[model samples]
Target: MAPQLDTQTLGLVFQSRPDILAGIQQAADTPARTTLFNDIASFVYERLACADAPDGPASKRRRLDIAQPPAQTHRNGHAQDSVPPAGSQTGALGADAAVADPVLLEVKDISVTAPQRKKYDLCFTKNFLYARASGTSVPVQGIVYPWTDIEHAFYLPVPDKSQAQYNYVLLPRGSFLPTAKQASASAVDRQQPLEPLVFTVPATAPKPGSIGGSSAKTAEAVSDTYSSLFNWALTTSLRSAGNHSCQLVAADPKLFHSVARQPHRPNEKAVHVKAFRGSKDGFLFFLPTGILWAFKKPLLFLPLDRIVAVSYTNVLRTTFNMVVELDTEGSSDGSSTVEKEVEFGMIDQGDYQGIDDTYVRRHGLADRSMAEQRKAKRELVENAKKAPADGEGDASAAGGADGMTELERAQQEAEQRLQDEEDEMEEDYDPGSDGDSEGEGESSEDEDDDDDEDEEDEDEMGTAED
Candidate 1:
């Protein structure tokens, strides 16, 4: 007689049956279908363990407790009688159970809306990362990245809606360049360029209109303080206060030692030291358009828009430094674009903070001021076009007395002036005119006398020859 098969063994046998596996695959609902697959997997694992048992099959099977139900009851008052499905907790304590544990890093079926982009639900695991539309599963996208890929992550606030903010993770292009050599062994093309990636995580709080709310206020305060300090510096300094179009925004007076490094010759280092007392060494200027470091040598100008960030640091509580990060033009090397950080040291700590705040605020306000100025100029031009011409209202009030508008009257006066000029020019060029004719007649008489003398001399010469 065949050995009597237990329920767990029967489950493993069902999984091995091709027809049953095909049926599970063809199931309409994914959740129910996956549950069936998990149940099959759990049963197979238990059956295999029983076969390799140190004790007899009966003892190994008893250890599994396959006949026992879950201690917790369901809302419908039914106990879960089967072994916990794969990817679920069975409350068993062992190395095998621990190895089968799963961690939920993120949830599925949840949509993350991005700025000016479509929504997607992203799922990440230890081995794979994929994204799909919020509800559908027809198309799935995968992301490939190095383990050490660098990312710039920041929170971006949405307008009006308080709870609709987003967290942006910017994966810059070539962030994985350092590990490209290792990745190239597996990649089809070793030299293929990598594109940047942006991932947006939706937030569930009140959205802000702009980033750095408290920081912006602090920046404003610092900027004001720096502006006052600049005025004081300019008054005391011996450097000529050059007239500028815009108001003096901020200034910094301090010494800076520049450390230059040669990329080609890594071992070479050059240090250039200078002092800015406002006389020989020029001071730094923060204008509406850009920031300028004015020195006796050529000045360094960085546009406000090109500036990425400003960071302040204090060294040993003695020296203060301000590092400005700027998005500059590409280098000669055919590498990806990067932000360059320029450091200026030997500044007052308070002044350094002020300068940093001023830099941030200035960059934020760069376009706003220009936009306002443009709008004002446009309004002025429009008003000028709509306003009455000079003396137009008076001329209109005078009615039919002068049958011309102020503009027509001005045109008439202009035409009269032009006519007078032309008449004077014609008179000056006319030979028959009173003043010019007298001078012309005297010259004509002298020419006639010369012709008569020539004719008389020719007659005498002919008579002498006969």
Candidate 2:
């Protein structure tokens, strides 16, 4: 069961992340509070662990310093807030200390609007990416994603919000931590796709000489964070296994030819193809890496290697839908491969030609159902080569004679016997047999005449005797 959020607990939570206080107040039920806390518990625990370290604030500051980008570090002047930026003992923090697992970059107060509406402070380390609740004085409960676990990261524009851009990270299905508190009987086992982690940067940098410039600083911080993740992904084991990298994907005309202007920014062209998944509306981005559906919950990223085919569905004069067939890690019950499909509907027909010519054809992802037919034909050829070795080739091929089923063979034998009896009857019928029938009729007539003469004589003798 989830922990109760009493006054003391709420105080600690607010102390950890003051921004969440508004969310807590907005939450009207117990389930909402449970979900809210569960989201940040991991981050909170990690923060508490670091704070309780025996070496004190010096060790913690060393760890945090590694995460700050160079620009942010200079602007804030670490000399005033933390220990000297010079050589420090990051090793005392223990086995996986900052020395070995140095933080590459960290961005605080990134606005996440999808999957859940909350703000997260993103920290990218050498081996992992961490997202903890924002506004926390000390890092605490948060989720961590290993560098290898991330399939790809996309930096895409938000629909209707022309000025803002958001970053989306895609992971494999079911890789996220489960939040269910009940047993299997009551727990729902429905699909739980790893909702992409979304965060955005300020549309424009802060006004010149603005106080703190937190928004502009966050924008730069987001850039540094993406760079750090990309560099780490380039060296991860996945790079060698399949060449998948976590680089940030943005609009490129070479990757997708169609570029249109937003309603608000008529002069500036952008690659923001609109589409829908179910009833929810979102935008589709065609990047050099793959296709990304963004600024919505259940964001989907389909990479080139996993894509089997792309087809247009529900096509109409004004609109069409794209169905993308993907390869999945098959079931454990001895099935080695499986296919899954996702359909993005209600796309404008005007963009169809551009999408078909640019991405689908270039990637060779167009309809490939004929490939299966060709495979079936090849199997037939192989079976023909292994046919039975006998003069009764046709019979064997038809599953007759040697290969005939029990019921079929019985029916064939019965038909053959009837044919033989008919042949015998035809052979026995001769033209001379008609003469023999005529002779037998003439003999019968002669015997009848003799019997009539004897009856007449017997009648004369009986008259004389009387």
In angstroms, give how far residue 241 of model 2 lies from its true place. Answer: 16
**Tens-digit lDDT track for model 2 on 159-234?**
5665555455545434322122343532343322234566665655423332122233434443344434333433
Candidate 2: TM-score? 0.47
**lDDT string, candidate 1, 240-358, tens digits:** 21212213232222221123233433353211222242244443445445555433233344556556665543322223445566665552223433437555555433233234334
Best by lDDT: 2
lDDT score at residue 105, model 1, on the 0-100 scale: 26
RMSD of each: 26.4, 21.7
Q: State the local distance difference test value for candidate 2.
A: 0.51
Give all TM-scores, in the order shown: 0.23, 0.47
lDDT of 1 at 414: 77
Q: What is the lDDT of residue 401 in candidate 2?
A: 30
